[model samples]
Target: MSSTNRRDFLRASAAAALSAAVPADLFAQSETAQSSPGAIWDSGSVRHLLPTVSDSRMLIKVSFTAPVEGEPRLHVGDLTVRGSMGDTRGEHWHFYATDLGPGRRYPLSLVGSNGRALCQPWELATFPGPDERPNRFRLLIYTCGGGHEVHKFLPTAVRNRLLRRGLSFQPDAMIANGDHVYWDLLAPVGSRLLGAAPEAVKAAGTFDRSAIVLGSDNETVLKRAAGPQIVPVYGTDFRSTPVFFLQDDHDYFDNDEATDEVVTFPPSYFMLQLARATQGIYYPEFLPDSARPLGLPWSSGRDRAWGVSESFGTLRFGRLAEILLYDVRRTQTMAGPSAVYIDPAVEKWLKARTAATEVAHVVHVPSNPPGWTAGKWGEWYPDVLGREGKLTTNEPKPYWQPGWLKQHDRLIEAMAAVKGRAPLVISGDLHAIAIGRMLRSGRLDLKDNPVNVVLSGPLGSRPGPLGWPSGRRGTGAMPSAHLDMEEQVKPIEQHGFTVADFTREKIVLRLFKWDIKTQPVEAIDTLQPFHTAELTRPA
Candidate 1:
């Protein structure tokens, strides 16, 4: 079947499942509540939430203030607050009042346990109506961050400053390509090595001092660790503003494995659960059931794992472009002939979507093949490199290995076949920023194959001084022994997120590196003007 058909089938299936999950009465209640002016809410302990999208019918996922110990009750009628989605479960509520309507300010009054009403500082204004014209959207991209140490936030601050300047130039959306959170590293020390040990040795090691300390106090360590707090803060700052999130190796499990295989690392699951719980992701609703198989097929061994596969489908914003959200992590291969490969179904879907679109822009969310050669930063097991010297055996794996230019060539072919359109590939993963144009071989019949590939990463993590593995460096800001791109493209060393502004006539990709010293540290480097690109329609 074609990709579009498959996607339609999947959506239909999910909608059916969702309909089944919510009974008639609950659905009617939600519908009624939505029609009425929602109650206003105050922001207190509610930190952050996830899957930020603007579809009115979309099932919103959120997280709010956890209840105090032994006092799990909150009386909503007492406090004065603003900008709330609404109350669902008793005492527990999710707010989505941002940008609701003109002149109508919605705020909620909350009654605390003390019988006093406190007002929340923030209010949710209704969102602006969709733009009728082709609207320009910017995406802030980053990936492969190891942890959220204070230093990590430094780069993000710098990038934010740059974005502030960039935003002045153009409006845009933020896309966190993957590795949004580095939860795997927060696992207690020595936990990653658990499976490598023999059963007897593992049992004995489990009782060791370090293991006992970590296992006993894993939650405490994770809460205090660099990632938990940092991710929420970073997410809160950006997610509320504008963004789309994709999961990478770090978000799912360290080095990219199914959830079941990495069960020994309790903190990984804990952090993910916390992220979901706090964000109001409605895990049971959005995620697929482990007991059943649907959407993308998985190995029998990989079934029954705690993971969710979601296809954002396609977004056509007026006449500007079509944005396709592809989940590459779910279909990854750990022990197969290759390390990374797009599922055949997904590949077909992508091809059909691109082929069907004549819109001025197309955005894909996956790390470009060329960026993988930067070497693993103490993340995944090193033994997985196949005999082909490539990470994966997928058709695109061989020519696309490391520093080879053929990866770009194959990518160009794929784009050219997409109804002969020139596509701008937006990606993250390598903890660095890159921008380049890929020109297809004349043999491919693509006159405009030289489309740009824009990448930004390390939003919270710091950029390393040099490329990895010394001799096999691919492409990065650092001068390396492996690949040299001085003639073709030069990488700049600014550690922050990236924002891409797309219009009908052109696509401008701007890199925003944050400046940490400023009080509201999310300032941009004034020196770097917007990096603009004017793309002509393909003939």
Candidate 2:
């Protein structure tokens, strides 16, 4: 054959062979994997691995490089958001895939409108489907983002330890029970008052919201390590593993007082606004009016007085389990203790979800402890006090009036009424790990209606009291006396996180403690069953 003809013949033969060797679907994926400059993903700019709603459908979040020039596109299996150029860029954008069942990993690829590949397409996780009874499941629980108790900032080493351990533990979900950010004291003043006398600690701010709320510079007093530092530690890579967030007193400005621009040390309007903005930005949430005319952000709305709203609702992963996340921070007000601590709508929501029959268990997440503590248990948050002429100081002094005490009484009544499932109560704020059976006010047999209280937290660090590296426990009033319960006012000396595993027969809790004296302790010492517990449906 002629030279030109022979070459053409050989090229055609090679092309045909290549096509025959590769699968059509594989070839198509490779073709689309190529990106154009108009659409790119900046992975380093990617943060916040949030699993919003995981069920038959999965809603995942992704953040892009600042000045995100174009819309971000997501591609996974048959799911794609090609024309869905969402309004948010350089910020957060959520997209979902329907018909996705639970308990499996789905491979995904994300690209910004600019064509930057966010991360080499990876597998995103999904919870177990309702019909399937997965033999086991797991979750990690944590609180207190302060690094070294004394350091009180994004302790990089500490965050690394948490990240490493969480990855190693392989929890199906992670619940940041409360106090993810300690914005109680803003900037300069906060630095000076890290662990000042209880009376002097406050939520004072400089009003330049950007500096402390989102900045990772630990030097700033309100440097919310949860944002710049801790979020990165978790990263968008864990998008498959759902992460849930809850707010406590610290997250709401000071320790517990929710505010509308008050004169007290805790609830400054600007600080609340900052917390609202920051909370909405960092976490994945089901906002106030999700079905409004357009997409509304979490914690804010044109309809609200201060553009702030609620973050309490129910999350279910099939019929296996359901969670009720309560908004204790926003529900509070300077309106005296007799006022409502939970929005009526939220309370209604909680009561209804607790009655769901499909789930094997119901978990209640209230930022503050439900059981009573001794004199001045939750003083920092300002829940039981009012801002009227009757009380002058914001400190947790003898400021609690009858009205405040009455409000707490209301909480007790509400807790007493919660039934249907043997409930699991997980709380933070005490800065220690403590667990005991909760007996309702008039019940003696905890076996039938026992309220198991599990305390988990201090992921970063926080000093307990004077001259002590850990917090000294304060005794509190028991919820009920008729039942077998421990009225624990014991001091908690350890600092760490809890990893919980759920099996068909029982749910197990493994408490991992760290050395408060060290930033990132080389080893994670497992505490005994005292910090752990196992439970099954009451017989």
Candidate 3:
């Protein structure tokens, strides 16, 4: 059958299954009625499941009702954490539990308004410290472009490949860097989308729309199921793997671009809120109970008016190395139509954290180097401010504005000051794979300073057949780029993820790619290694 026909058939099959699973009473209720408190109790898909921090913590967030109102009480096995209810743009309930540990698992259930079981119990687990005997941590990162659509075959293909590779190949977490769903199809001209829309509108417009556009026939069934099923299936593929989700531009709107007047949108924000409520894989639930309430203090009148304080945080693997995850996108400041600046607070945080830790490695998600370039940082070029309080318009046109340059300089200097501490950067915005070294002086001097930047593309998303032509190192149709290196790291069109194995001797990073299919395909393609060299700090 043609690809379109095959997709249609699959959608029909999924729709039938969803219809059978949903209780008839649910179909009869008005959209508002279905969202009312106690209404979710009737949902087979809706469960009072909370993503736990670790094996010891009792605190958990219960997700069931739509736009979860005032905090609810949570009981996990023998433990309990009283939830402090807040809303992410008055859309979904934001819950928090301050006390929790690392490396543990717990079973959690919810207590309804009447103190009875409202839904089935679910389990959550915490990440282990860096030193904890090298437990396998599977992280799946993917990117979304305007043309790309989520396909059942994509997920199915990923599951099959991992299955063939065995449990060892299963991922511990998943990151949807951005564009989790396409919203340009839903928007008309320039009116912004807010996250605080009624739950029904969100379901019909965003979730259901994405389902149809993505060709998921079970979209309605998945939508009616109450909680999201995609992440659960991926998690279930393994014996309950924890997921860490990150949103990119697509998740918020058609692209990451937002006017200074309006910051957040409804579709992306609503999707995020729902992801949190349902423990969807697209949203990171494995973060410590401490990381709950993840958003900025800013109060813009936008649906997804929430932002992570500083996307940069340290995850210590015992005493091995501190994993610094930076949210480069959120810290940017836009002024007029000319430049963007990184908030001073984030800059201070990055500098201070790097200086304080003796970590052997530093990992950045958006690994594009400082200075502007095409497709990557150039899109936001006007926002980058210069040191002299103006925009930089030097020849070759910097990829970023002045403000961005300052922030980039601060990060690079801080990392360099670490005195030979090997920094490994992993990025996924580009939908292609490559490996290169980051240098302070644009020169490829290995001795002075060296940082490994790995650009790994989509895990399962369809990246059309067109590939970048050879010799066109940094600029091309493919979504991959890296700092100038001795040997140019060319972009490779493939569908898969990258695995970084850090040992005492050296860090081994591997790229794994496969075709989309239910059955496993043999012969996975692997990439060559790029070693990290030792650097010397100035006295």
Best candidate (score: TM-score): 2
Which digits, one per residue and each the tens of the lDDT, describe model 2 over residues 361-450? 667777766543322324322222224422223444433334434443344344434555556777766565666766643323344466
lDDT, residue 539, candidate 1: 61
lDDT of 1 by residue, 250-272 (tens): 55434432232333222244434
User: Between candidates 2 and 3, which one is better according to TM-score?
Assistant: 2
Best by lDDT: 2
Ranking by TM-score: 2, 3, 1
RMSD of 2: 11.4
Consecutive 10-residue window with the lowest summed lDDT within model 2 = 13-22
Q: Rate the local accuracy (lDDT) of all candidates.
A: 0.39, 0.50, 0.39
> Of 1 and 3, which scores higher on TM-score?
3
TM-score of each: 0.58, 0.69, 0.59
Write the residue-wise lDDT of candidate 3 on 1-539 in tens digits. 58565434322311111111223132133423211111112222233332323322322233344544444566543656565443232222323344456555545555444454444444455555544644223344444322212222244334334332322333344444443443332232211332223432354443443332112443332343322323332322322343334444444333333343434332344444343333231233333313223332221113221222223333444444345454444444544333334356545655665666444454555523232232433242332223443333332233335455445545655665566466555655555556666554222333355655565555544433322212212343231122334323555555555655444434555565554433234443121213223222233
